[model samples]
Target: MAKELEAGFTGSPVEKPEGMRKVASDTASAIKREANAVAIGVSDHPQAAGSLVLGIGAAAFGLGYLLGRSSVSTRTRYWR
Candidate 1:
């Protein structure tokens, strides 16, 4: 145990492989390209973008309200 402790661990630091780095770079480029495309689309059609956002918001709100009501009813049923 003492000898093992004295030698200690000596290893090279772990690093991301070249393949992973290339993959990450490619993914970032793709995301940037897509975002730029979306920006251009939204800029070209502001009214459509606004309506899309509002529709998403309304859908999210409705989902949340339904989930909340279902949970309340479930708890009351179990309590009785």
Candidate 2:
């Protein structure tokens, strides 16, 4: 046990161990901010769901219009 203690004491001195505290605090604060963001997302779940549905509907309508136009063009060109 004495030899182990001596060995442990033989390590180099830290230049600034206090700097580690700042890093720990920064990490903790970032984690807290992310947690708050998740909470806000949960709170807005209903609105998000509605927006997703609206987005999908708009995309489908746009795709359908494009495809219909292409098909019409092909038919007309073939008839000519």
Candidate 3:
């Protein structure tokens, strides 16, 4: 047990890096493919995409405004 502990890892360091490189490349390619698909879909339906984006932006702005109004301190000061 002590000898094994002292020896630590027996595998080559290069193996770990090669596996990580393959994983990174696969993830990058998947993201690129999904992005291209979304771009093509948006281009095919520009009006729908624009409407959806506008609706989402408007909803976000309204939510922020309501939150800001609700958080204001409106207590009346006795001496001010």
Candidate 4:
């Protein structure tokens, strides 16, 4: 195993290092554009409105749950 490993390490050719930085920069640019697009999409419509509604609803539910636990006859109090 040691002989085979030594032979493999001694025999391989080295690679060229050109354009690696350029590739990295290009990949970063693409990721930034995708993130901006997603941000714009999320900001743009009925889905955002729906998300707001859901947030409000969850908050209201939490508040109601907390208040309900502190009182007696929750259904009776809300009826009037």
Instruction: Give stretches of model 4 more than 4 Å off.
Output: 1-18, 46-80
2-49 per-residue lDDT for model 3 (tens digits): 553555777667644458788997899999999999999999999999
- Regarding lDDT, does 2 or 3 come out ahead? 3
Collision pairs in model 3: none
Model 4, 1-80: lDDT tens per residue?
A: 45544444664347643598668878999999999987787678768868988999999999999888888564644455
RMSD of candidate 3 to the truth, in angstroms, is 11.4
Per candidate, the number of residue pairs that clash is: 0, 0, 0, 0
Instruction: Indicate the TM-score of model 1.
Output: 0.69
Candidate 3 Cα errors over 4 Å, as ranges? 1-19, 78-80
TM-score of 2: 0.37
Candidate 1 per-residue lDDT, tens place, 1-80, comes to 44546475588548654797879978999999999999999999999999999999999999999999887844435455
Instruction: State the lDDT at 73 in candidate 1.
Output: 46
After TM-score superposition, what is the CA distance of residue 33 in candidate 2 from its true location, in Å? 30
lDDT of 2 at 77: 44
* Per-model TM values vs. the true structure: 0.69, 0.37, 0.65, 0.36
Candidate 1 Cα errors over 4 Å, as ranges: 1-17, 74-80
Better of 1 and 4 by TM-score: 1
> Who is ahead in lDDT, 2 or 4?
2
Model 3 residue 72 CA deviation (Å) reads: 1.2
Which of candidates 1 and 2 is the stronger one according to TM-score? 1
